[model samples]
Each structure stands twice: as C-alpha cells, then as structure tokens.
Target: MHTLLKNLKVEINDKLYVKDPESSDLGKRILSCSIEMIYELGFEQFTFKKLGLAIKSNESSIYRYFENKHKLLLYLTSWYWSWLEYQLVLQTLTLSVPKDKLNRAVEILTQEVTQDSNFSHIDEVLLNKIIISEYSKSYLTKEVDIENKEGYFAVYKRLVLRLKDMIKEVDPAYAFPASLSSMVIQGALHQHFLKDHFTAITDCNSTTTPTSYFLNLIDQLIISNGKK
Candidate 1:
C-alpha cells in the first residue's frame, strides 16, 4: 500500500510477450493471476492454462500475452529488476555519504519485501520469492542467448551496473566493482533461499538479520578493505 507512486508502469522487455499485458484489462488479469498461481504452485507447475482458468479467460488469451511459461518468467524477472532499479535510485539518491548510499543498497537487496500495491496485478513480495527460487531457470535454458538478444537481460545488467557505480564511489581504487556489487545482490538472494530451504546453511535466525549480515559484509569488503 505504498502511496507515493500511483499506478506507474514498471516496464519490462516488450519481446517477452506477444502482447503487452499492461495494455488491457485481460492482459492485466493474466499478469495478476499468473503471479498468484506461480507463487502458490511454483514456476515448474504453474502454466498458462492454469493461469487462464484462474482469471476465467481462455488459454488462447493467455498465450496472447506470453509465448510460453519461460517468457512469462523472463517478463516477471525483468519487471522485478526494473522495479529494483527504480527503488535503488529512490532510496539512495538523497544521501550525501558513500557508505550510507551503499548501505541503503544492501538493505534493498537483502531486507524483507512487502507487496507493492501500485501494480495491482503484481505482488512484489511474492515475485521476489519467485526470483530467489526460480530465476535460474530463465537463464539455464538453451535459448538464453536468444533471450538476451531480445533484451531479456537488459534491466538486470543495468541494475548491477548502477550498483557498481555506488561501489566505485566508496572506493575508486576497488579492483572488482562489478563483481562485488553482483555478489552482494545475488548473495543476498542466495541467503534468502538457504534460510527458507536449507536453514542449516545460513545463520539468519530472523528476518532482519540478513540485512545486518550483508551490510557488515559489505563494510568489510568495500569500506574496511579500502582502508587497508
């Protein structure tokens, strides 16, 4: 129920869908129901047919929005990264401190997510879960290069590069800005997965601790490492 932005579009790659899902009511329903069903049933079991039934639309209508489940997955992942890019800018731009901005970036990557009510069809919290669990499937396919060529990976690359800039601001001499930034983002996602599916692999006993752990780790790597 964030009230600041009212129904703004989080643009995804146009090629991921046969038709734009945000352009019409049925398309919107396709998105909303797909997120709901995917979150409930998991990406492996979720299908356009099942999603169509959830929204009381025909399978053909769902197909109009996406080529297959994989495209829908890419569309969802692209949307999430786009949303994250906006949020990172919004949360960090006001700060005058480099470490503070970097710390804000860590929190966004690691902290608990809430459902963003702005996009009524998309549950960001649930979509985040899908990203943590099922995102690899999008790239693990044989068509990954083809998908990349279609702009499926653009938002993710942009997000990582923007965060990489914050790392360089903290330490211009840092040798691995891109590597470090991507590590923090993907590491946090891995921690979430471990905490949920393999508790013994992670020490986060509560929801808030992942944010602390990641921030401290970033401080060690970026802030403290710069001093040495």
Candidate 2:
C-alpha cells in the first residue's frame, strides 16, 4: 500500500518535494488524458497504464497527482462543472436584461452541444455515456446531491432562478415551478441531441438548430404563460 503524507511537503525516505503550479498542470494533464482514454475505450477498459501511454507520461507522475482512477473521475467531474460555470458566466455577461441573459444561457448550452468539438462525433457519444453514468451514480450515492445542497449547484441553480424571476416579472400568476421551467429550457436545448430516436416517432423538423428552438420556446412559453 502507498503511504500518505501529512503536509504540502511530501517526505518519502528523508526526501522532500514541494508541490507547485507545475504539479497542478500535471494533474490537469493526467485528468485530460484519462478522459480521452475513457472516451476511446469504455471506462471498464480504461487503465492508468493506457492513460500514461496516451499522454506520454509515466504512471508515477500521474500517481503524484491522483491516488487512483476513482479520484481521477471525480477530478474530471469537478473540472467539467468548473468549466461549465465559466462558460455560463461569460455567456450571461453579454446580455443586459434578465430575460435576454437567460435566453443567451440556453443558446450557449445548445451551441455547446453542437459546435463544441469536445462533444462532436464519437466524443459526443462517449461524453453522453459518461454523463449519464455519473449522474445516475451521483443520484444514488448522495455525494453529488450533498454537494448540490451545499451550494455547489449555485451556477446552474442561479441560472434557473434568474429565469424564474424573469418569468415572474413578466407575469405574477405563472404557476409552473422554476424546476419545471429549467427542465423545459434544457429539454428544448437538447432536442437536437435527442432527435435521432425521436425522429421516427414525431413529425417535427430536425433541421432546426438548438439555439433557435430554445429561444423560440422561451418566447412562446413566456407569452403563453403571461396571459394566464
């Protein structure tokens, strides 16, 4: 078994090493490499040995950053959430009105699904698999649920809350819950991603872009609900 260190200065057999930004970069590299490998090969087939080969880094270097594969997965999840928050902030800042800001947020999310090369082609399938699996596990394990309750869900939650507030301003009698509004927004944004199997069952045009559908849906929802 590997021995644990107590402080920033890790001592192994009278040797001391200081962790720095380079170490952090190394950790990120390892996480990125692991994500790529997991995308190429399913998680069950992904291994540290394979990841090291893909990144051209030694396993010992990776171990210095992460204790095991599970820890690496957690790190990847955190990285995704952090990057998503940054994206949302950048998108939200471009608009002045709350309604426009929420609209832009939906547009950004939809555009991300189609335009982001990270989620394009085969990588998209891999990512969807990983997201579905992680979400299910998080739901069951209570770790992610706990994190959400503790305010780690602030970015996404705040985006929804802002949208709900806008809806309220437009119409006080809007009866739908914020959660339902958020889901509808997300569903509208993800329609393209879900179109493959859905096409056979529905007559809706698949040619429409996610951003267009999202904005149209938001406008219609607001107009219809405001009259009630």
Candidate 3:
C-alpha cells in the first residue's frame, strides 16, 4: 500500500488556497510549518506571522499560499480526508465480504494515525490531532452554507457516503445507514478528544481505542438489526 501511495496526490479544492502549497518549496514549508505551529499553539493562537517566523519567511509569503488561517485549516482538513479516503479504498478493495469490508472501513476511520513517510512535507499524525482538536472551527461559522456550496467539505462527505454504501451492503434492511455512517465518523473524533482530555467520561483509554468501541457498536447495530 505504501508503494502504491508513494506517487499519489491528494487533491484539494483550489478555491481554498491562493497558490498550491505542494507546488513550491516555500509553499510546502508554509503548510509544514503551519501544521506544527497549529498543533503546538492551537488554532486560535496560530497566525501567519508566527508561521512566517517559524519558517523564517516573510508573512507575505504565507499569504501567497493561503488567504488566512481559516482557509489554511480548511485546506489541511480537506487534505487529511482525501488522504484517508485513498487508504480506505485501497485497503478494502479486495474484501469480498460486506461485514469484513465494513469492519475494515470503521477501523480505518477511527484508528490512531501514524506518520506517513510518503508525504514527508506534512505530518499526518499531527494533522489528525488537529482534526480531533480543532476541526470544528473550520465550519462552525455563519458562512458554512456558502462554503458547503463551494465544496470545501466534498471529500469528507464523499468518505461518509462510501461508508454508508458499505453499511447498506452489510444490512439492506437497516434504515439508518447514512446516519450511522456520519455518526461513526464524527463520533470517532469526539471519542478521541474525550479520551485525550476528559478521560473520566469516555471508556476509551490506553488499553482500548475509539476504533474498538465503534467496531463493537456497528456490529451490534447492523448485525442485530439485520437479525430482525
């Protein structure tokens, strides 16, 4: 899978950026440094000025790639989802059993992220941490509807739809496949956040992960519903 993904490019909405960050060294540096800075300082405290200082480049240079920190966050989240969809598809492509495919899909979506050497410029693990911690700020705005029409979240929606289809295949009688699919995706992020900060409220811990919890939940819901 790593070999197949070596040359893969995770496409993002061009409208999210003034310039393609992957096109030049400076632009890539902006993305790489911004990820590190955002993870270190959190999104509210992250700024292009801080990113510029971190990368030792002018603030104006960062602007060439992203109009503002909000757009940069959108770009990063979009990239993460697109990259995830690639892995989900490749990893589950050969599974002939619907249940097996669905299980793999859940694991892929909820599993802990590790750094991918294929994309050296971006740290996927840190990006996943950002998604778990700061993703909501990207869309919890008055302009979300406008941005939705502009397709800022198309990749994420498509990923959910892919899982929804798998759920339907697993249990054609299940009436809430789409709802369950979206919940699993969002719930995984929420559970990860809970485990990291509000540990007392969540069952997930060092011994168990969000992936394990969701796998059990899905099997009970889908399989039990199918039995009826």
Q: Which number leads on lDDT?
A: 3
Model 1 / residue 54 / CA error / Å: 1.3
Q: Which residue pairs in model 1 clash with each other?
A: none
Which parts of model 1 have CA positions greater than 4 angstroms off? 1-4
List the candidates ranked by lDDT, beginning with the highest.
3, 1, 2
Q: Cα deviation in Å at residue 195, candidate 2?
A: 3.0
**Clash pairs of candidate 2?**
none
Output the worst ten-in-a-row residue range by lDDT, candidate 2: 7-16
lDDT for every model?
0.84, 0.53, 0.94
Once superposed on the true structure, which residue ranges of model 3 sit more than 4 Å away at CA?
A: none
TM-score winner between candidates 1 and 3: 3
Q: Which is superior by lDDT, 2 or 3?
A: 3
lDDT tens digits, residues 12-92, model 1? 878888999889999888877787788899998998778877888788988877899988888999999899887888788
Give the TM-score comparing model 2 with the true structure, all chains together: 0.61
Q: What is residue 179's positional error in candidate 3, in angstroms?
A: 0.9
Best by TM-score: 3
Which candidate do you rate higher for TM-score, 1 or 2?
1
TM-score of each: 0.94, 0.61, 0.97
- Give lDDT: candidate 1, residue 126: 87
TM-score between model 1 and native: 0.94
Q: What's the C-alpha lDDT at position 45 in model 2?
A: 83
